[model samples]
Target: MCNYGGGLGKSLKPFVEYNEPGKIMIIETPQSKSAQLSACWGPIESARAKVRGAEGVIVSGNVRQVDQFQDAGLPVLSRGIAALGPREYMRLGSVNETLAIGGLKVDPDDILLADDDGVVVVRQQELSQVIESCEYGVKHDEVVLQAIAEGSTMKEAWRKAYDLLGPPVEYARPFRR
Candidate 1:
């Protein structure tokens, strides 16, 4: 992940070099005392990163070239888009350090699972437990699916799942308050 201001430095070579299979690039530019613009990269930069083997990019700020990025099949998540480029305003920020992203402290090598549903990060230390929970969830849902397939109503199948698997797990912050 990278923390930068509105301007993207002259080169994004470092980020491209760091890109590897199974790795996702996450960028953040929080609201600052300035105009608070977060301009990291546009579609062209996104394509470059993808070509270098980045699985996807998650931007906490704005990006440009939306249509091109989407057509290229490079997964990109951003708050919005802008016409401005980073030629004048870009600067190199911190990389591979703990960063505050969407109220979460993200670390290097953490597992990021993002989809239409949303994005979730599993710290490296809790990976095993998270995987086990995911496995259990898949199996539990399978039973509900089977019941629905067997002519049970959606509500009925869900009730059966609750009875069999117990209540859904409650949310808990990864770190202590």
Candidate 2:
């Protein structure tokens, strides 16, 4: 019953094109009543990729479309899927509404970062700052992981993990047309 039709069905591109080398993480805004739906659908449309061309779809509420979304190789991160469609529960709700997902409040146009590890929501204003912090964290963690990989003791690696930060800067969303 759930749909991967509409824009959700197509390849999502805006996210893919916009995110570039970085992976796009979609944090769904939560729903009050049926929290499970939010676990897949969240409460908004922004989290659902445009369905034409997208980096991936991360369902905060609950997501269906296993065969549809999966067959296309669409990058979908979902808590789970139900056979019921949106019409079964709600209808005519517009896109771009504020959403709560995974216990996080996600606004429209917030910066979402993700990878094999998982997802993180960077507030619109804090996006750049977070990237700066995370980039440094990533580099340092790499070194630490490398040391451990090279037969270094866990204690030593842990000790060396400190002060591995680079300059702390800000994360600003680029001005769009």
Candidate 3:
């Protein structure tokens, strides 16, 4: 589930108890720089979250305890790292609610996909379609790469793949929001 904060005090029990295991923990702070007073969470809390079965955490603000988190194998994606703690600056703000982070509106249960490339959010209803498209793209790219390896020009390989796979049915439509 999602949690919102403005950096006040420390009480994450509600979030831990409410969040489902294997789901992402998204912590949204204010957009302004001044509001991010300290690190949102540290090693202790990361451990707590791991024990509770959280898949990972995405913080709009800063985070700390990088080594400890890495050792614990807990994935944490944040704005940056910090040494300051959150205990003195954060309090429960909102839980399981919608948040506008980085100009993107994120709602609870939205599919959050994060990898080395970055993060992408897919609405729950669009998950299946997105997956299908991704699978198709992967297969198509595989063909293109194979063709290129066999000495075809990049443009020729792309043309051959397109000719074989045909254009996507949704190519004419705008992307789903």
Which model scores highest in TM-score?
Answer: 3
Clashes of 3: 5
Measured on C-alpha atoms, candidate 1 has an lDDT of 0.72
TM-score of each: 0.77, 0.58, 0.84
Query: Model 2: which ten-residue window has the lowest total lDDT?
Result: 1-10
lDDT (C-alpha, whole model) for all candidates: 0.72, 0.51, 0.74
The total number of steric clashes, by the backbone 3 Å criterion, in model 1 comes to 3
Q: Is candidate 2 or candidate 3 better by lDDT?
A: 3
Can you write out model 1's per-residue Cα lDDT over 19-104, one digit (the tens) per residue? 67668888776555232454567877877887888888887777776776787877888776766655434454667767787688
lDDT of 3 by residue, 50-129 (tens): 98899888888788878877768778888877787765336667788887777778888688888656678888777778
- Which has the better lDDT: candidate 1, or candidate 2? 1
TM-score of 2: 0.58
Pairs with steric clashes in candidate 1: 7-89, 7-90, 8-90
Candidate 2 per-residue lDDT, tens place, 66-165, comes to: 6554545446666667655443333222245455554566665667665556767677676567767768778767878988998889877766766454
For each candidate in turn, give its C-alpha RMSD to the true structure in angstroms: 3.5, 8.4, 3.0
Ranking by TM-score: 3, 1, 2
